[model samples]
Every structure is written in structure tokens, then in C-alpha cells.
Target: MISKLNLENILFLDIETVPETAHYSDLDPTKQALWDAKSRYQRKEEYSAEEFYDRAGIWAEFGKIVCISVGYIKMEGEVRQFRVTSFYGDEVKILNDFKTLLNTHYQEQKYLLCAHNGKEFDFPYIARRMIIHHIELPNKLDLFGKKPWEVPHLDTLELWKFGDYKTYTSLKLLTNVLGIPSPKDDIDGSEVYDVYYKTKEIERIVVYCEKDTIAVAQIFLRLRGDQLLQEHEIIHV
Candidate 1:
């Protein structure tokens, strides 16, 4: 099925998120209580809500997107390139800009969005965050009544799962096992909060996110029996 798809029709992406505020105390009393309740099962008795606050970025209600890096295969004058770019800074603007891109360029059924664990994380996270800001859902992200196979989205992790539903694989693990370059050499999801909240290094996170996006595209190519993208072919636009 993948062989029938055009590589240029797919927009590969990854997102970086952080808690809405720098600290737990930064939340209002109502949100603080909500956080405590929402994370009850995950934290259990091992960690308090405040202690688990760093992980709030994993949930859309308690988090905001900081960076959304996207890459797509493009052709220019007989040259093929995987051009990558990022939308960072304000959350609302980040989302609106991405929506514009989808609505303008990738609205067709032929264009699919791909990410590692995207169906589980990146895709839904973006949709939820858009809804939080009252942004209208683009055709690609709006999955209201679409059938499972009708949804024009792809997940490398889901592909990697094949028929096994119980196992989970991180992007780092997949890239390593597949002989692709590691995107986690600098920072990972766990340290994103500290990097954004403490150091204010958004560009650093943007680079990390773009690497993951490229890695997603590479994984798809590999799964389809194509060559891994060379460094010279990856362009940061």
C-alpha cells in the first residue's frame, strides 16, 4: 500500500509541548484541582500532582504546543529535497499557521500526515489544542465522521506494530533498530519542559523536533523499501 503512495504527498511532522505555565503554582486553583484529578491514575501514590506537573505536556488540557516542525519531500529542478520548517512561539499562531498550510496546500485526499505515534499523540494533540483555542479544524485534522481507513493520516509506530497491539516503541528505538540516525541525541520529551521553562531555548527544541520529523519520513521510506535520506538532502527551510 505504501508503494502506491507518492512520497511528496505526505507531510511528516513532530511537535514539542510544554506545560501551560512554568510551575504548578502558576495554575489557578481550579486548574490545579483539575490537574490533580486528571492525573490520578497515572501518578497514583508514587508522585504528587505537582511532582507530575512536568508531564502535563503529554495532555492537551494542561499543556500548550511550543513547537511544531514539519517536513515534506519536494522537487526542484531535478533535485529532490526533504524541506523542513517549524512554527514556534505563541501557541495560537503556531496552530493557525499550520492550519493555513494544510488548508492551502494539503487539503486533498492524496496528502497524508505522518508522524511517529502521531495517531496516538501528535495528531490528536494538535486537534485538541486547536479546539481549545477555537480554531476551526482543517480537513486533514478533522476526523469527526471519517472511517478508520478513510482518515488520511499515517503513523510509523502503528505500521511498526504490524499485528502486535500490546507493544510500544519509541521513535529512538525504531530509528536505532532501523539503522537511521538518532533524533534524540540532544534532548527528549522528558527534558522539554526544563528546556522551555528554565532556559527559554525554543530554537534548541525546534531543531530537535525537526530531526524527529525527518526521522519519521525516513522510517516511512525504509518501510516502503526506499533509500534512507542522506544528510545533503535534508533542507531546513
Candidate 2:
């Protein structure tokens, strides 16, 4: 089925997020207590909610998106070019710009949004964040009442699973095993919070995020038995 789909019809995406605040103490008393309850199960007895704050970005309510990088295959004659761009800076602006992209360009019934583990992470995170900011969901992200088959999104992680849902695969590990170039040569997910909050190195995270977007595209091609994209074929805009 993957081989039958048009590459240009899919938008490959990745997002970088950080905790809503730099520290647990930055939250109001109500939010702090709520966070404590929210993270209690994940924290178990090993770590307190304060210690677990670094991972708050993983939850939509506790985090804000810092970057959203998207890529798509552009076919010009015999050339296959992968064009990448990002929406970053203010959280609301990021969501608004992304919504514009979806509404203006990829709103067709045939289009899809793809990510490494998008179904589990990127896709829903973006949706929840958009709702939090009072932005209307673009057709592709609006999955409120659609049937399962009516959904138009793809996850490289789920594709690789092939019906085995027991093991979770990271994008880095999947790229390594699939022979695609690793996108984690720089900072990883763990350091995104520090990089965005402490260093304010948004461009650095944008580059990393774009690489992941390209990697997701490459994985989709690989799954369809196509050649991997060459270095010269990927463009940043």
C-alpha cells in the first residue's frame, strides 16, 4: 500500500518541545500540585515530581512546542528534491503558521502527515497544543470523529512495528537498523529542554528537528523499496 501512495502527497514533520516553564517552582501552586499528581505514576518511588519536571515536555498540557519542521518530496522533471522548512519561536505563532500550511496546501483528502512516531507523539501533541491555543485544527489534524480508515496520518514507528506493538522503537534506533543516516549526532531529546530554555539555541534545535523530518521521509521511501535521498537532494528553506 505504501508503494502505491504518492510521495508528494505526504508532509513529513517533527517537533521540538520544552516544559512550559523552566522549573517546577515556576508553576503556580495549583499547577505544581496537579503536575505532581500527573507524574506520580511515571515517577514511581524513585523521583519526585520536581525531579521529573524535565520530562514535562512529553505531555501536551505541561509543555509548549518550540519548533515544527516539515519536509516533502518535490519532483522537478527527473530530479527528486526534499524541501524542508520550520515554524518556530512563539508557541502560538508556530501553531498558527503550521495551520496555515495545512489549510492552504495539504488539505486534500489524499494528503497525509507523517512522522517517526507521529501517531503516538508528534501528531497528537500538535493537535492538543493547537486546541490549547484556540486554533482551529486543519483538516489533516482534525480527527475528532473520523473512522479509523478515514484518518490520514502515518507513523514510521508503527509501520516498522508491522502488527507487533510490544516493543517501542526510537527514531534513532530505527534509522540505525534501517540504514538511514542518524539525526541525533547533535543534541538528543533529553537535551532539547536545556538547549531551548538555557542556551536559547533555537536554530540548533531547528536543524536537529529538520534532520528528523528528513529521516522520517527517508524511512518512508525505504519502506517502499526506494533509494535513500542523497546529501545534495535535501534543501533547507
Candidate 3:
């Protein structure tokens, strides 16, 4: 139960990423000239979109992070209140800002880091980028050398062990099963890059990240036997 968890010590985060470039061919390369003439920025030397999907890193076609959303919650008496702090900027800036917040606030003992699919994607991506930028990760996020289940990681997706191992389900699907309202209004994972680049609107990405965090929170509440906030109870923490 999250009620037994040290609420003040835990932090939840989610990230939105986009493809770096679209130059590689899934088929035979017909244009040696096109590949040579393209600017270094446009050239993706490490990985392609397919490879990105598999490898799951900065090299992945999702070149950079457009938004990083952090949700902090505490048991304020009998009620659990939450505050969402979203960071939006260039890749470095967003990562740096997030690191700064973690250093200032969550750098402590016995703090469990929670995220949806974090064990697989979000946590690793952030840690890799942070290391690339020479930023020191907080104690809670220092999960590089540990085994997947060995680390102090809480993934709601993993918690829902109720489903068959072959039947992978989305957070949205789990939310639906739990009777939680879907907050998936903004662009989805597919449109992440286009939305971030075309509109340069991090707010939309922020909302998307926020919805995921809130969904995770709701999922946590359900698992912990806490009262899930209704439509009207969503007053900002």
C-alpha cells in the first residue's frame, strides 16, 4: 500500500520524447549523395526509428525530450494531496531543471521512485541523458547497476500482475478497467515529436505527461485502498 509508503520521500516522473531525424531507409539505401550531403544535425548515425523503439535511449529516433513532468504527493492528514511541477525547455534545460528539483527536494533516504513503465523506459532514458549531460542523479534514481526488480522501483504496470503475462495492457486500458477517467486529450506517443517540433508547444506535452502521472497516482491510490479523487475533488494541491 502507498499509504504505508513514505509519501514525502517519493516522486513520480514521466517524459515525452521525439525522433531525432528521418533519413534512414527501412529498405535499401538508394541515395548515397543524400546521406552525404545532409547536415550533421539531420544525420542519425546511432539508430533509426525501428532501432530507437528497440534500444530505448537518446540515440533512439526520439532524439530529445520535449517535456518532463514530475508529480509530488504527501499525505496531508487523512487526505492525500498532490502537486504537479512540469518542466519544459530545450533537452538540456528540462533535464537540468528536473535534476535541480530532485536535488533540492527528494535527495533523501528511503525515497521510492514511481512511474508507469519506468523500469523499462522513462527511468533509463532520463538517467542516460542525465549522465550524458554530466548531471549527478539523485539517490532514488541511481538505479543503473541494479537488477530490474532489485531496485527500489515501483511500476504500476508491473503491479497489475492480475493480467496474463502474454496480455500486455496500456496504462489507459488499466485506468479504464479501474473506472478511472482517461486524461488522454493531448497528442499521444505517436504525435509527440511532431507536436513538440511543429507547434513548439511544450504545454501540450506537459499536459500529456501530467495525465500519465495523475493516472499513475490514481492507480496507486486504488492499489493502496485510498480514496480516489472524483471530478470535483480535483482542486489543485
Give all candidates' CA lDDT scores: 0.95, 0.94, 0.68
lDDT preference between candidates 2 and 3, better one: 2
Clashing pairs in 2: none
TM-score of each: 0.98, 0.99, 0.76
> Which predicted model would earn the best TM-score?
2
Best by lDDT: 1
**Model 1 has how many clashing residue pairs?**
0
lDDT by residue (tens digit), candidate 3, 83-188: 7767877778988888788777766657677888887778877877778778788666787687755677788877787545666668878899998878676567
TM-score of 3: 0.76
- In candidate 2, what are the lDDT values of residues 34-122, reduced to their tens digit? 99999999999999999999999999999999999999999999999999999999999999999999999998899999998899899
Off by over 4 Å in 2: none
211, model 1: CA deviation in Å?
0.5
